[model samples]
Target: VRQAMVLTNNPDKLRALAAGGVEIAGRQALYGSLNDHNHRYLSAKAERAGHWLDEVLDTRSSRD
Candidate 1:
C-alpha cells in the first residue's frame, strides 16, 4: 500500500533519476524530454494524476 502510495505520488523525472522506463518523480508524468510540469504547465499530468488518486484515495472503501 505504501509502495503504491509513493509511486503514484512522485512523477518521473528523467534528469533527476535513472534506470528509466517509467516512474513517478518530478510529480508529473514524464516521457522522453517532454514533460507536463504540473497542471498549469501540464494540465494533462495534473488531471490524470488527480483522477488516479481520486480513485485510489477515497476513504470510503480504500482500507478494505
Candidate 2:
C-alpha cells in the first residue's frame, strides 16, 4: 500500500504534523531576493526564511 504525503513550508506546522505522526518527506525550495523591496522599506525576509528552511532541513549547506 502507498502512504499519503503532505507538503508544507511552515516550520511550526511541519513540527506539529511530525508530532502527529505525519511523515516528513522533505522540504520544498523557497526563493526570494533580499534586494526585493518597495520604496517604503527594506526587508530581510528572504534571509530569515532561508534560516528557517535550513533549520527544518537540518542542513548547513546551501540549497540549489
Candidate 3:
C-alpha cells in the first residue's frame, strides 16, 4: 500500500484530497518560507506518519 501526505492551508483542498482517498498528514496554514513553528509542526507530522508506516509494515511482515 502507498500513502500520500498533503501540505495545504485550504480546508476545501484538504477535504477534497481526503475524499479522494489521500491520507492527510497535516495542514500548513503558513505561507512563504517555513518558520520554526511550521517546521516543527511538519516534522511532528512526518514523524507520526513514519511511525504509522512502520506499524503497517510490521503488521504486513508478521502476516507474511
Candidate 4:
C-alpha cells in the first residue's frame, strides 16, 4: 500500500479536471485490450500511485 499522506496530498481538483468526461467511461475500448506490458504498467500505477485501477479491473471482471 502507498503512504496515506501521499494519497491524501493528491491534487484532487487537477484529477477531476483531467478526468472530465471520462471518470466513469468504460475502458472497454482501451484497457480491455491491454497487452502484457500495458497491463503491468496499469497494475504498477494502481499499486504505487493509488489509482482506482484495481476497482476498475474488478468491475470489468464481474461483468465478464
Candidate that would win on TM-score: 2
Candidate 3: pairs in clash: none
lDDT leaderboard ranking: 3, 4, 2, 1
TM-score-wise, the better of 3 and 4 is 3
Worst 10 residues of 2 by lDDT: 34-43
**What is the per-residue lDDT of model 1 for residues 1-64, given as tens digits with 9 covering 90 to 100?**
1111133333333322444334423344223222234224333444664433333233324455
| Candidate 1: segments with Cα more than 4 A from true spot | 1-8, 14-16, 19-46, 49-56, 60-64
4-57: candidate 3 lDDT, tens digit per residue: 565554456666777878777765444444444455554554365432223323
Highest lDDT against the true fold, candidate: 3
Q: Report RMSD for candidate 4.
A: 11.5
TM-score of predicted structure 4: 0.36
Return the lDDT, model 1, position 36. Answer: 33
Clashes (N, CA, C under 3 Å) per candidate: 6, 0, 0, 0
Whole-structure CA lDDT of model 3: 0.51
- State every prediction's TM-score relative to the real structure: 0.19, 0.39, 0.38, 0.36
- Where in model 2 is the C-alpha error above 4 Å? 1-9, 36-64
What is the Å distance of residue 34 in model 1 from its true position? Answer: 30
| Runs in model 4 lying further than 4 Å from the true structure | 1-32, 59-64
How high is the CA lDDT of each candidate model?
0.34, 0.45, 0.51, 0.47
Question: Candidate 1, after superposition: displacement of residue 4 in Å?
Answer: 17
Q: What are the clashing pairs of model 2? A: none
6-64 per-residue lDDT for model 4 (tens digits): 22222443365345532432222223444545667767766777655664456546666
